[model samples]
Target chain A: MNSLLVSLRVALATMLVCVGGYTAVILGVGVLTPDSAQGSLITRPDGTIIGSRLIAQKFDKPHYFWPRPSAPDYNASGAAGSNKSPTSADLTDRAKQTVERYGATQDKPLPADLAAASGGGLDPHITAHAALYQADRVAPARGVAREAIVALIERHTFSPGGPLTPDRLVNVLELNLALDRDFDPTSSSK
Target chain B: MTAMVFILLIVGGSALLSWPLGRYMKWAMDPDETAGPGRQKLDRIFASIAGTLGTEQQGWKRYMVALLIFNIVMFTVSFAFMALQQHLPLNPDEMKAVEGSLIFNTVASFTSNTNLQHYSGEASMSYLTQLCSLMWLQFVSAATGVAALAAMARGLAGRKMMGNFFVDVQRATFLVLLPISFVVATLFLFGGMPMTLQGSAHAATLEGLQQIIARGPVAAFVAIKQLGTNGGGFFGPNCTQPFENPTFWTNAVCMVAIILIPMASVWMFGRIIGRVRHAGVVFAVMLVFLLAKISGAVWFEQAPTQAFASLPIEQATGNLEGKELRFGAATVPLWAVLTTSTSNGSVGAMHDSLNPMTGLMPMIGMWLNATFGGVGVGMINMFIYIILAVFIAGMMVGRTPEYLNRRVEAREIKFAAVTLLAHAFFILVPTAVFAVTPWGAATLNNVGPHGFSEMLYEFSSAAANNGSGFEGLGDNTVPWNIATGIVMLLARFIPIILPLAIAGSLAAKKPTAQSAGTLGVEDVTFAAMLIATILVVGALTFFPAAALGPIVEHLKFMV
Candidate 1:
């Protein structure tokens, strides 16, 4: 009986320290870094909350760079991958359709990352190579030089230093926002 | 080339950190050791609190009872919080109460430190429950395992009494887990992981659509989730979620965090028993398995997924489906192996979308489980395998089995055998029953061998206290929740308690003087024996299931 009481006291005390104390400390520290603490929400010039720098947004228009295919249609609230098996016919059919949609020919193939769905469905970035592959469409649609669009992608390409880091990545939303800022694509195209 | 370098960095970085952290853990957990005035004050406070609760040195039976009772309290508290979460404060999203069986399953899951989630966190759980119930359980449950391990190590060291359970729990929580978690959580916050009580943020996209971007106190949750080997994510896709794991550096940090403590645990055990050389040999064997699995996973994932074989896309980048472009193909497979190997089952990519051979690597990790396994309990599991190896070697050499100068008689072997057998039994038996029933077959998101692999992986994860899943399994059903819940509970307590029992039995025996005939546990030959024992036992039990699932799937893909 004393053991049970001890167990209870131990559980409660541990909970207070771990859940209460630890969280309070982090939350307090979090206030100092408000931008990240509040989900890194990005705002427009007019101060409208546009999106997060981390989360992927849907972009199918020719003027903007598209992200990887999303199983949840880029639903941030319902993040998930397609979770398709390698041998599943449904998975194969979907991949084939994605390939067809990308208009990949023998000479000009889509990047594998572009043809595949991301794990979270809200993957914000694409490979720099994948972004470069779509330069022709984006450049024409935005009425910008192809070289300029490629240059924009290069400027946006990010690689956290080290051999362990993934290859250069370009955040699709950031590049599109940059396009709007420089080229005024919404006014120019639409 | 970069992939190989990445693997080496992660492994090497963890090994480097483990040594110093192991020494600190020894200092913190030791009853007689004090670092400074601060530690002495903290120790006095804990001692007084324990004194109020009757600070008697507990035997194995008493320790087990205290543990069971504490876990029951955890289960009850978590269940109440989850079930009544709708009525609780801090639920800014007004999330509803969880369903009956799911509540049971989740409570059992976190209480046992298995953390197998049947529901997505962003959609299903309230912030109150996430912090107060689930996250609370994550800390205490991991501390429970660490405390149990400390007691078991003391027993093996031939201490007349295992340390007081309450005091050990206090030390493990305050001294070890909390301090490390605070630092890691701070790092995660700086890496752009959200740490807020606010509801999911509303964002108007550039495409003029509303996206409810989920955010909460994730940085805090993820720190303990990885550090404690409790991989219950604050979001459904776990670390795959960008907000939870924002960048390559965060990805590297999470991967390193997953294995750091578990690696440190082997050295902690060595310090406890005063057997650093033996621990070094054991650590080397575990590292060998870990490197081998990492190599296999990375190699296998280099193949374009069979599903995309005929698609007119560049497959040279390897299986990119269900993988983040930011982390790429190499890091995902590495994370898969590391997470499973350590029983820290957070994923950077979907295991279900992995190439068959790649998927096999994680399964193999869970099957052998002791390749630098979960924080403290992993070392306990490895100890079970060591005893079995010792007994078999003893039989072969025509002498008595002894470890650390303690005789491993029939009782000890029986305890070890039961613990080993129970793990296989819990995993295989339910998988067999469920694979044929509506319970399992109805929930599968893939057909054929991949379908079977989902069920096998679920039970294996549950039984191994690994929470990572195929995720393709639509496993939020009542049957899955209930069945896996029971398996997690049994698998957790059996391995833990039985090892303690074995340690207790060994403690009662007089240390026999070592002779030339006695088996040397710290050398290469014993390493070979231990490796062989793990492979033979693990393979013998799970080979048929493996053949049916990933092996057959790989063959089919080849054809």
Candidate 2:
């Protein structure tokens, strides 16, 4: 009984210090962070919230760079992968369709990210190869020069270090937002 | 191919880092010794924390009671937070309360350091609950395991007075877990994983689609989640979600972090008991098993099964269906072995998607449970094996059983038996019960052998307190949540309680001088016997289950 009481007392005290005090410090530090602390909210000129830089948004329009296809649709409330077996007919059909839609030639097969769905249905970025492949289509549709679009993609391209240090990734949302700003300047604020 | 190189780098780096860190861990846990002036100052600081808590020297029973009560308190507080998360401040997502059964499971899971997340983190929890409740327990539960090991080690050294639990917890948290986590968290934050209190990041896709990106203070959680070997993720997809893992450097770091402490604890045991060579024998045994499992997993993962030959994609790039392209082939399987070997169950690739033979590696790793197991508990589990081996070897050689000169008698053997048998009982009995039940059958996403593997894997994971799963099982229902909750509680506490009690019993006895008839654990012959015993015991208990599940699944695919 004495030990239990001591145990309880010590536990309660530790909880107060570690859970209460330590958490408060972490929260304080979190608030001080530039973007993510506030949800990484991107805003328009009128201060209306647009979206977050971390999450992926739907970019179905031909004028924009497409994010990787999400499985079971991009429902944030219900995050899931398609969980398709490699041999599943559904997965194969979808991949084939995606490859054809992207106009893959004999010389260049569709990048895995382009033809396949990401584990998280809401992957925010696409492979540089996928981005480059779609640049030709996006430039002609948006009435922008192909070279200018490729350059824009290059600016937004991120190489996430390590062995993939040379392999670039383009955030579909960031590149799209930049497209809206460069091509249609008046609507950049809104 | 690059993944193989990265895996080598991480393994080599951790092995190099473990020597100094192991020495530091021994110094920190030992009350008598201080490294130098710098450590003396830190020791004084820790002493005050113990003073504030009124913690003094405790015997084994008193130490166990204190640890249990603290865990109980933590469990209750964490449950309350999950239940009332909606009303809590910092809930920008306005997430509602978790259901009653799930709250029990979640709290029990975290308290045991199992971290079997039934609910997706972002969808279910608020930032406050994640940080204060879940993350807090991650630190404490890890500290609890370390403390248990220290107390038990003191007993193994035949010390009458075990160290203070309060002092152990404080040092483990403030000194070890905190400093390491800070460096890793800083690395993650700089490396692109987002740190935010915001509910979710909303963005527009290039295809003019609106996407709500799930964002949280992931970097901080990810660091402790790996470093502490508490494998819960802030997202449902766990580390596979790009936001949680982000880049290759973070992924490599996370894998290294998973095995780092468990590896060190082996050497720490050596330092504590003043038996460095004995620790090396044990470390070599663990490394052999770990490397064997990793190699097997990698080989199976790289070769596409005949069943998958029908898929064009599998033919082109091996089995890339359930794996992230960023992690590559070798790292995915390496993560499987690393996570299971250390009881750090965070996965970068889908375990459920691996070939059946590859899937068996992790299950067997967990079954063995002593191959560099969880934090401090892993070493204790290894000690249990040591005791058992000593007893068995004594019988074989026709002499009295002794370990470190302490007599191994019936009571010690019984305790060790209970600890080993408890894992099989909790795992097998529940699996059988679930296999017959309609609820358990309903949760399976695959049928036949694969379905059986999924159910078996759930109970195995729970019993081992290694929380990675088959992922296809719909385990959010009342039965899974409650049953696994109970299994986790019993498996975690029973092993801990029994081992400490045995250690206490052993500690009370006077050490006898080693006779010519005595068996030393440091002998290569003894090490071989120990390895054979582990393999035979594991194979006998689990081979049937494996045959029914992954082994048979592998056979069917082969034919």
Candidates in order, TM-scores: namely 0.98, 0.90
lDDT of 1 by residue, A1-190 (tens): 7777777787778888898899999999898889999998999888888999899999878788898999999899889999998667898788777777778886887888888898999889898999999997888888878999999999999885355555888988899999888898656575
Weakest ten-residue segment in model 1 chain B by summed lDDT: B47-56
**lDDT to native, each model:** 0.89, 0.78
Q: Encode model 1's per-residue lDDT on B1-559: one tens digit a residue.
A: 7777888888999999999999988888864544777777777777666666545778888888878887888888888899999988999888987889999899999988888988999999999999989999989888888888899999999985888778888888898889999999999988888999999889899989999988999999999999999999999999999988998888889999999999998998999998999999999999999989988998888888677677678878888888987775678889999999988888899999999989999998898889998889999999999999999999998888999899999899888888988999988899999998999999999999999999999999999899999999999999999999999999889999899999998998899998888899889999999999998987678999999999999998855
Q: How far does residue B91 in candidate 2 sit from its true spot (Å)?
A: 1.8
Candidate 2, residues B151-253, lDDT tens digits: the string is 9989888897888887788778877887787778777766567776666655443344565667777777888899887899888878888778766777878
**Clashing residue pairs for model 1:** none
User: Which regions of candidate 1 deviate over 4 angstroms?
Assistant: B33-38
